[model samples]
Target chain A: MRELLERKLVFVTGKGGVGKSTIAASLALLAAQQGKRTLVGEIDAKGNLADFFETGPTAFKERELAPNLWGMSMDTEESLKEYLSLQLKIPLLAKVGVLARTFDFVANAAPGVKEILTVGKFLWEVREGHYDLVVVDAVASGHITGQLAAPQAIQELVQVGMVRDQTDWMIEILGDHDQTGAVIVAAPEEMPVNETLELAARLREETVVELAAVVANRVLPELFGRGEEEVFEALAADDRTPSPADLLGAAVGGPVRPILDGAQLAVTLRRTRGVHLARLRDELPTGTPLLYVPYLFQRSHGARATRQVAEHLAEELGY
Target chain B: MAARQRTASAGSVEQLLAAKEIVIHCGSGGVGKTTTAAAVAAMAAVHLGGKVLVLTVDPAKRLANALGLEAFGNVETQVPRQAFLDAGAEPRGELWAAMLDTKESWDDLVRRHAPDAGTRDAILANPLYKNITGRFVQSHDYIAMERLYEIHASGRFDLIVVDTPPTRNAIDFLEAPERMADFFSSRLLRWLTVPARSRVLSMASKPFYSVADRILGSKFLEDIAEFFLLFQTMYKGFVIRAEAVARTLADHRTTFVVVSTLESAPVREAEFFIDALDDRGLHLGAVVLNKVLPPWFLDEGTTATAKAMVADAVSLAKVLPEELGSPDQVGRVLREVGESFLNFQVVANREAEMRAELSAAPEVVASVPYFDHDITDLAGLLQLGEQIWR
Candidate 1:
C-alpha cells in the first residue's frame, strides 16, 4: 500500500467537531516537513483553517503558510471563474467575469456544479503538478460522498458541454488510487468511529476515491501499566493506615483525594474509549492503516497543536 | 454510579420541558445533542404526566435497543412501560421515540399538499424531483421542520423534542421555512420554467440560456424546467405550509435549546445559535453544556498538590508502605498519576475559560459533567437528565 503522504491528493473528512481541520493541517504540515511541496485547501471558508496555521486569513488565492506549504480557501465561484477562463480562453475579462458570475449562480442551483467546482480545483493542482501533495480539508463525513461523486454526476447529467469534457479528466484523477485517496479523521467515540467505518465502505462503493488510511485522533494515553494500577488502588484505599493518600496529603500539605479522584476519572475515561478503540480496530478493513494521534491537552487549537499533531503523525508513520 | 438529584426547580430544564409544547435541540455534531434531547424527553415522561415524543434523526441502533425497542422510523413508536420500569422509573406519562425518514416525510408532504393524485404522482415520478429532494441541502431542513409541524398540529403528544440535523451554517435550520417559500416563489424558478421557445426568443434571457444550455445541456435544463412546471401546481400549498411552519417556530409555546460541549468549535456554534434565537424572538429556554469536566479539576489546592506530587515523586513514593510495589515502581506510578492530573488540568482550565467566556446565557444555564460511559439506557439518560434538571 502507498503511504498517505505519497498520494498526490488527499481529502480529509470527519464528523463535525471531530478535529477534521486540525488533522488536515497537521498532515499537510507533516508532508511539508518531510520536504514535499504541499498545497492545503479548506473547502469551507469558516476561516478556522487559518487558526490552525495561526496565520492571517487564507483567501481564494494561494499564500505561503510555511517554507514548503501553501494554503488557500476554496471559493466555488472563484473556481468556476478560473475553470471558465482557462477552458474557454476568453480574452474579455470584464465580459467573462460577468458571464462566470452568472454561471456560478446557476451552479448553486444545479445539482452537482458547485460540488464539482470545489473538487475540481484541487484536482487541477495535482494534474498541473503545482504541488507534490494537495490536502483538501473537505466537507464533513456525511456530505463527502456527494462531493466526491460530483464530477461523474455532472458528466451524466450534462451530455455534451465544456463542463462535460472537463469532468472526464477529473474522474480519471479521482479514480486512480495511486493519485488520490481519502483519509478519515475520527475520535474514539461511538459516532465518529462508526462514521469512519461507514465512510470507508462508502468511499469504495459510492465514490472513486480509495480509503488511504484511518486516523484515530484524540486517543487517550494509558495512565498505568501492568500492576501499577494495583499500587494506585492500594494507595487510594480508605481503610489502610497512613494510606498513600494520607502520606501524599501530608507531604503536599493539601488534600490528595481530588488528585487521586482525577486519576481515577482519567483511568475510567481511557477504559471507556478503549472499548471503542477495540471496536474500531477490529471492524476496519484488515489492510487499512490505522494511525493514532494522542490527545493534546493544549490551551487552544492553533499553530502549537498543529505542530504537535504533526510530530505525533511523523512518529506514528515510523519517521 | 449514583446520580445526584439536583433541584429540579423553577429555572431548571425540567421546568422548560413541562411548560413548553415544543423544544428543539441544535448543536454541532458529536456534542451529545441526541443524547441530551433523549435524556430530557425521558425526564419529561418520568416527571411530568403527558405523552412525550422525542423526534431524533439518524440515532445509533444501540440507542433504540437501550430504549427497549428494536427500531423505529417515520411512525412514532411508544416506548414500552416495561422499559421505563426496568430503568427504575415509574413513568407518569408515556414516552415515545421516532427517527426522521426524510424521503418518506417528503412523499407524505407531496401527498397532502398536491392538488390532486395525478399531479402528486407526476411530481413524485419526476427524476429531477427525486434528485432535488434528496440532494438539495435545504430539503432535509425543510422536511424535518415540515414533519414537526405536521405532528405538532396533530396534537398527539403533549411535549415534542426534536434533534435537528447538523447544518453547516448556524441559522440554516431557522431560515429553512422562509427559504423554501422564497425558492418556490422566486423569479429564478419562473425564469427557469419559461416555455423553451419563449426563453430563447426573449432578448433578456437569451444570454443566460445560451451560457447555461452549453454547460448544463439543453436536455437537462428542459427536464428541470418541466419538473418545476409540474411543481408549480402546488406552489400555493407549499407557500402556506412554509408560513405555518415558520409561525410554529416563533410561537411562544415553542422554544430552542442549544446543547454543546465546552470545546471551542461547539461553543462558538452554540453562541451563534443562542444569538440567532434571541434575534428571532424565539425563546431560548436553556443552554445544556454536556461533557464538562468536573469543577474539582479546577480546585486551587488540587493543582498545587498535583504539582508537588510530580515534582517530589521520589520522596512521596518512599512515604507509602512498601507492600504495593518496589520504590522505583511506586515512584513511576506516582509520577504517572500526577502527570495525568496535570494533563487533564490543562483541558479543564480551558473548559473553565470557555464556560466563563460564555456570555449572554439565559436564565436557565445547565451543565452536565463528563460521563465516563455512554448513556445507553433510559436509566442512564434519566441519570444524566437529573444532573442538568436544576
Candidate 2:
C-alpha cells in the first residue's frame, strides 16, 4: 500500500518553491538504489534536476546520472518530433523535419496539443517498458491538473484521428490507480498546505491519477519535549535571581542568550507549522500517506543534499 | 547588520515607490512576492499620499480577509479607511485591491473588442475559448498585463502595484502583449481560417492540413478554425490595445520590483529577472529579500558561546538555578539549545553566501527579517511594511 515507486508512472508536483524537483530526484535515486531501473524526467524546460543530481545538463536525450538512474528534460517540440516520426514512420527524415518546424506554430494555435505531447511521451515510456519506474518532476500544482487531465481533455476535444486513437490507451494507463499516481510535495506552510488540499480534491474531481502521497519537505524538528519547554521558559524568565541568561553567560564565558533565543525561535516555528500539518492530515482522505523530510540545513543543492533527502524518504517509508 | 552593500539602496526603494505609477512585483513563486507587494502598497498608502491599488494574483485566503475583501474578484475594492486607522496608520491616501479573475477578464476582453454583439456572444459561446485560455500558461501572464493597462488607462489610481503571476519564464508577461498581437496576426491562424473562410484548400496547405486533420480530425479543425476566425474579427482592436499595453509596460513610469528570499534558487532567479529587466530598458526598481535570518545567528562570538554551552552542558545546567529544572533535564535543554543554534547557523551561512553571490545591480535592496508567524490582517501587513519602509 505504501509502494508509490511500484507505480509505472509517478508525477511529482507541488506549489512552486516547495522543492518539487528535489523530491522527484530523491524518489528516483531511492528507487535506483534499490536496484530498480528508473528514468526520471523533468517536464519544465528549465528544470533544476541536473543541479540536484550534480550532473551535467539534461536534454531530450536521456543521460545516466547514476547507475540505473537516467535523467532527461522534456521538450514538447522534441516530443512532437519523436511522436510524429513514430506515428508517421517516415524513413526520409526531411519530411518529418518540415512538420517539426510547424510544431510550435500549430501547438500554440491549438490548445491541448503541447500538453498531450508531454503526457503522451511519459505514457509511451511506461507502455514501452523502457524502465521499471518513470518519475516525472511535473509542473507546479497550479498547472499539473491540466497535464494530468490532458488525455481526457484531448479525447473530448479531438473527436477522431491518430491523436484520438492514442488517447484510449493513455487513459487506460492513467486511469489505473495501481500504475499511475501523483506525489504532491508540500512544505506545511499556510499557502502550500491550502494549495495541497485543494489539489488533492481537484485530482479526484479532475484527473484519473491517484493521490499516492504528500511529501512534507523542510519539516522543522521539534526542539523541546513536553515539560522541557516550560523549564526552558522559566530559565529564561527575567525575574529569576541571577537570570539564566546571566548564569549561562558567566558559565560559558560569553553571551549564550542568542543561543537560547535561537531555541525559542525554533520551537515557535515548529509550533506554527504543526497547526498546518495537522490541518493537512485531517483534511486529506483517510489513509493517504504523508511523508516527512526534515529541513536540510545544507550549503546548497547537490548530490549530497539529494541523497540526504532520499535517505530520509526511505526511512519515512520504513525501508 | 543588513549585508546592504549598496549604501544608497534603501532610499531608492522608498523613492522608487513614491515616484512610479506602476510597480510590478515579479519573481519565482513562493518567495513571498504577494506579501511583499501588499506591504509595499500599504506603506505607500500610509506614508506616500496617493490612490494606491494592489493588483494581486492568487493571494492566500487570509490575505483577502485581511484586506477586508468579502468575496474578491475582478472588481476593484477599496480597503476600508477603518482598516488603516485600526493599523494605527493615519493614511493620506487610499488603498485598493483587485484579484485577477482570468475567466472574467477574458470575457471582459471579448466584450470590449468584439466587433459586434453577435461576434461577442459567439466567441463567448466557443468551447475552445473557455478550455484553451484556462489551460494556456501564457494566457494568465497576458491577461494580467492587459488588465493593468485597462486599469491604468482609466486613471483610477495614482499608483498600481501588480503582483505578477508565477510565470514559467522570466519575461513571459513582459512579452505577452506582443505575443497576443503576433498570435492574432500569425500565419498559422491565417492559414487555418483562410481555408475555412473561402473553403479553398490551397496546394501548399493541403498536405499540412491532411497531416493536421489526420491527428486532429476534420471536426476539430473546424472548431479551431471557427474559434480563430471569430477572434480574427477583433484583430484591429486587439492589436492596437496590445500595443498600448506593451507601451504601458515599457514606459519609464512603470517600474519592476523583484521580490525573493535569500535562498540560493530564488536569489539566482531574482538576479536573472533583474538582468532581464536591465537588458530590456525596463526600470529595475528594487529587489526585496524576504524572510532573511537575523545577523546574530552568524555572529562569531555567539558561535563560540554555543560551542562552549554544548561542550560543558552538565556544568552549565548545574550552575543554573533549580527553578529552571533538574540538572539532567536542564543539561539536555542546554545541549539542545546549542545544537539548534549550530543548526540555524548552517542556514544563515547559506543565506549569506547566496546574498554575496547575488550579482544583479538593482537600484534598491530591502531586507525583511523572517517573521515567526503568518501576517493575517491590515495591521499585520503594515507591521511588515515597517521592515521594508527604509
Candidate 3:
C-alpha cells in the first residue's frame, strides 16, 4: 500500500460486483491517511463511489470528499473537450458550441474515441502532478484492459502527431514500474477469481503496466478446525429431538433442529469460501501478493465498511 | 401453447420465452446476467420448443462456457443436439449462439450500405476506420444493435435473447441506434464531407493547423480528410440502417428484462434502468434478481429457540471440555455457526425488503437463490432455469 501510495497513479479493476468501487475508495482513503493528496477518479456517471462517502453525486470537477481525498466522476464529453483544446491548441474550440457536435461525430465515427478521452483524463491528471496519488476505479474487467490499452492503440494507429505524443507520455507513465501500478479487486468466487487471473495474465502480456497485487474481497473466515469437523458432524447428525433438559437454558420457544441446520449451512459456506480462496491463491501469479478483505455482512455498504476494509488494507500492505 | 393470462406480476420466464420475439438481459456487471441469459435461451430452445439464438455483446467468452459450447464467432453455431439430450432435455427447437464481432459487423454494415465496392473498400482500408471500429467505446454497442437488427430481420429464430454488456454500457446499447442516426444526420458530419470547405477553414485557422500539423503530422490530417471524404456518400445508408434498427428495437414483440442480484447496488441500478426504459417507452418484461440468498426456514420464534439451544450447547461445551473431549472447541464452532446463521438472517431479511420494494412498483420479480456452484454447464443452466421459471 505504501508503494502504491508513492506512485502517481493506481488503477483498481475487476469483474463487476466484486466491489471495485469500494476497494478503490478504500485505497484512496488509505492514501489520504498516509498524508498523501489522493484523487479517486470514477468513470461511472451514476456516482456509486460518491454514495460510499454519503457525498452527493460526484461532479466532473473534483470535490474534497475527505481531509486529503478528492473525488471526481469522469465525463467523457468534458474530457474530450479538454483533449481537443490540448491537442489542437485551439482554445476557441473549447468555447464553441460545435465541440459537442464534434464529440458526437468522433464518438460515432470512432467507437473508442470517447474511451480514449476518458482514459486520457486520468493520464493528463497524472502528468500534471497536482495530486500526489491518483486512483482510477476503472470500468469492469475486460473494459479495463481496453481503457488502459486505448492510448497505445491510438498511438499505434495514428503513427505521428499530438495523439501519438500524448499517448506516448501516457504509456510511459503507465509502463513505468515505479510510477504506476494496477491492482485487481475480486470476490472469493469462481468467476471473479477466474476473471481476475485472466485480466492479470493479459495485463502482463499486452501492456507494460506493473501488476501490483490482488485484493480478494469478501473472503470468509475459517471457523472449523480439522478436529472440530468431526465434532461438528456428530453434533449436526445428532437429529434426536431436544428434550426439556435441552430447552432448560433456552431463551425462546421452537425446534433446535433449525438452529443445527443453520449451523451446518454456515459450515458449508465457510468451507466453500475456503476452497475458492485457496483456488484464487493458487491460480494468481506466484509473486503477486494477495490481500484478503473479510466479507462485509452490513445491511448497506456505507463508509464504515469501506473504512474497515481500508484499515485491513493498511495493515496487510504494512502501511 | 396455451394463451397465458397476463397477471399483475411479471410473467414467468417460460411465458416470456414463448411470447416475446426479443428478450434482452440488462443489468449491472457480474450479477450472473450472462449466465442467466444463456440459461433462459437454453431453456427456451430445449424445453419450451422454440428455436433460440443467444447473442452476446460482451467482449468476454463467458456465454460460450455457460452454454457448454466452445467459443463461437460472429456467425451463429448450433449447439449440438446431443449436449441438450445428454443434459436430459429433449429439444424440439434448436439452440444457436454467437459472439458479436464488432469489426466484422461494421464491415458488414459498410458492405451493405456503402455506395459502391470502391467506396466500401476505401473506408474499410482506412487505418482510422479499422482502428476505431475495432476499439471504439460505443462501437461494440452500436454494431451489436446493428447486428441484432440484421438477425431479427432475417427471421432466423423464434426467439432472440441478447446478453448486453453491462449497466451504463447497456444504456448505450439501448440508445446506440438513435445516437448513430443523429450522428449521421448531424450538421458537423455534413461539414466534414466537403473537403474544399474544410481546407478553406483550415487555411483561415493557420495557427491551429500549424500546431496540429506539427503535433499530429500532415499525413494524419490527410487520412482524416480522406476518411471523411470517403464516408460523405455513405451517410444516407448509415441513417437508413439506424432507422431500421430503431424500428426493430421498438417493435411490439421486443421486451427488455433487467437482471440483477439481491445486493443494494444492483437493485438500485435495476430500478434506475427500468425507469430509463419507461422514459424511453421501451417495454420491460421482467426483472430477474439473480443469486438471492434463500429465506431462512426457521421463523422468528423458531430461530429464537434455535439460538437459545445453540447458546446452551456453547455453555455446556465451555464448562465440560475435558469430560466432553474438546467441548470448548465445540462451543467455539457452535458460536460461530450461530453468528453465521444470524448474519444469514440479516441478509435474507434485506433481500426480502428489496424484493418487496421492487414488487411494490408492480414489476414481475423472479428471485433465484445463489447456486452452490458456478453455473457453467447445461445441467446447471437447466437447474437455474427451473428455479427461475418455477
Candidate 4:
C-alpha cells in the first residue's frame, strides 16, 4: 500500500484473458480502503468496468462504485467533450461541439488516435489531482506499447498546437519515474510471458515510468510434496484397491476418486506453472517484482472476486 | 455465381471448403474464432478429404489446444494429421497449424522479397525500416496475412483457414500488406531518402558522416538509393503481386466465414465484417455462431420441489443466483438476469434473421451451442466437430 501510494498513477496491463480489470479494480479498492481517494479508470471501448462494478453499460461516467472509490470507463469522444468543456473552457454544446466531432472523426480515422485519446484522458485526470491514485486498466499487452507511447506518437504527428501542448504535458507526467508506475500482468504461459518481457523492455527504453511489477494470474497452487508424485503413482497401481467405478456407488459417494485424480493432475499443472514463473523471473529485468495469483475456481468478475484478487495483491504489495 | 452456391443455413461447412482455397474467419475477441477455424480445418482434413492448414494470430493458446497439439511455434506442426489417423480414417488429407510471429515473419518477408542481397541487408539494418516493419503498426494481423499468403503459395495444402485477429487489428492487417507496399513506393519515402542520404554524402563533417555511414552503411545507403532509383519497377511488381492476392481472395475459390457467439457484440461485429467483405467484393460462405447457451434447462422450481420432498435438497446456489431478500433488490437482480437471458435470445433470434437476410446471398453453414467445458483440447474440438458435422 505504501509503495502503491508512492506513485501518482498506476498502469496495469496484461494478456487479454488474464483478468486485468479485476486486478486494477482490486488495487483501486485497496487504495480507497487505506483512506486514499482512488479512481479506477478503464479505457476499453467496450465499457467492461461498469459491468465489473455490477452496473449497466450506460452507467459509464464517473461514479462512486465504493466508498472513496470512483470508477469511469472512458468513451474517447465523451472524454474529449469533457476535456474541451472543462479544460479548454469550450461551451458544452456550442460550435465547438461540431469542431470536436470533426476532430474525433479525424482522430478515429488515424491509426492510433483512439489509444492516444484514451491515454490522454488518463493524463488529464492525473493532472486534475482529484484522486490520490489513478489505476488505469489498459488494453492487453499486445497493444499496450502503442497505448503508452500514444501521446508521444501523436505529439510527433501533430505539432504546434494545444493538442501538442497536452501531449507534451502527458509525456512529461508519464516520463517522470516517481510519478508513474507500470505493471505487466500475465499468465503462466509461453506467449504471455514473452509478451510481458517485451512490454517491460519497451517501457524501460521509451519512458521513465518504473516497471514496478509483473502479476502472473491464474497460477495453479502447488500442492503436495515432490514425493507425492510417486505416492499417487503407487495409489494408482495398488492391486487390492477397489476400482474407482466401485467407489462411484451411492454408498461410497459420487466422483470422489475422480476429484482426487483431478487433484493429482493439478500437481503437474502447478509444477509447470512454477517453472514458467522461475523462467520469467530470470529473464525479466533485475529487481522487477513477480507476483503469482492462484487460480480461484470461481469466476473473477464480481465484487467478491475483486476482493479475493485484492487480498492476493495486498500480500504481494506487502500492504 | 459464387453467391448462388452458398447456403443461408448451410447445415455443414463441408460444401464451403469444396471450392475455396482460403477461408478467413473474422470476429470479436472471446468468440471462439480459433476453435471454429480449427474445427473447419479439421473438417476439411477428416470429412472433406482435403489437405488443410489453420493459421492463427491469436496470442492465446486456444489454437494449439484445439488441434490437440502441446504447443505451436511459428512453424507449422503436424498433429491433426495424426489425430485423423487415430480416428480410423485413411488420413488422406493432412492438417497443419502455425501461430504467426509478426516481427519474425516481417523480417523473413523483407529478406525474401528484397531486390538484392545488398537491399535486403540494408532494409534489415535500417532503424527506420526496423521500426516501421517491427513496431510501427499492429503487426500481428499483417504477419498473419503474410503467412497466409505464403501458405497459399506453397501448394502444401488444398485449403487454408485463417483465424483472423480480433476485429480492428484484423482489418488493419488485411490492408497492411498493400499499405506497406504502397508506402515503399510512395513519394514521401523518396523525400525521406534524400535526408537519409545527405548524412552519407556530406563530407564537411567526415567523422559524423563516417559514423552515420557505419550505422547505415554507405554502400547500403547507395543500394537503397539505387533501389528507389528503380522505384517504378519495384512498385509495379509490388502492385502486381498485391493485385494477384486481391483477385485470389475475391475468387470463388476463396471464402470468408465470419464467426461469432450468440451475443450482441459479436453478432454486431460479424454483421459489420460481412458488410465490409461485401463492399470489397468478397463472398461470404458461412456464419458459425459458437458457444451459444442452451435454449432450455430443467426448471429450477421443479428440481427443488423434487429434492425437498425426498429429504435431499439439491443445492441451487451454484446454478442459480441467491435470493436477495428485498423485493426491489430481487427485482433489480431479476432485471439484470433477465437482460442476459434476453440478450442471449436476441442473439439467437437475430442470427436466424441474419441467416434469412443472407439466405439470398450465401448459406448459413452451422450454429454451435454453448458447451459446459472450455474448448481447450483435441477431445473438446472433436466434440465441437460432432455438434457441427451433424
Highest lDDT model number? 2
The superposed Cα distance between candidate 1 and the true structure at residue B386, in angstroms, equals 1.1
Against the unseen true structure, what C-alpha lDDT does each candidate score?
Answer: 0.87, 0.87, 0.76, 0.63
Clashing pairs in 1: none
Cα TM-score per model: 0.96, 0.97, 0.90, 0.62
TM-score of chain A of each: 0.97, 0.97, 0.91, 0.89
Candidate achieving the largest TM-score: 2
Candidate 1: residue B151 lDDT (0-100):
93
Docking class for model 3 is acceptable
Candidate 4 residue spans exceeding 4 A from truth: A58-60, A86-93, A109-113, A155-159, A223-257, B1-21, B26-51, B58-157, B167-390
lDDT of 4 by residue, B1-390 (tens): 122444335545676677789998877665667778887777677767667788877755645765667788788887755665555455557788887777788778766667788767766675435434444444555567667877888898888888887634335655766765665666545543554456443343453234324322454444444445433335555566665666677778888887776444455556667777788787887777675544332233322332332232122111222321333332232232223233333334444554444334446556686553445556567668666664
Error (Å) of candidate 2 at residue B7 is 3.0
lDDT of 2 by residue, B49-160 (tens): 8899999887566777887667566899899999889878899999999899999999999999999999999999999999877876578999999999999999999999
True contacts kept of 4: 0.00
Total backbone collisions for each predicted model: 0, 0, 8, 12
- Higher-DockQ candidate among 3 and 4? 3
Off by over 4 Å in 1: A90-92, A95-101, B1-10, B197-200
The deviation in Å at residue B128 for candidate 2 is 1.1
Q: How far out, in Å, is residue B5 in model 3? A: 17
Q: Which regions of candidate 3 fall more than 4 Å away from where they truly are? A: A80-113, A238-252, B1-10, B59-66, B196-198, B202-218, B306-311, B316-326
DockQ-based ranking: 2, 1, 3, 4
Q: After superposing the true interface residues, what Cα RMSD does each candidate give?
A: 1.6, 1.4, 4.0, 15.3
State the number of backbone clashes in model 1: 0
Candidate closer to the true structure by lDDT (higher is better), 1 or 3: 1
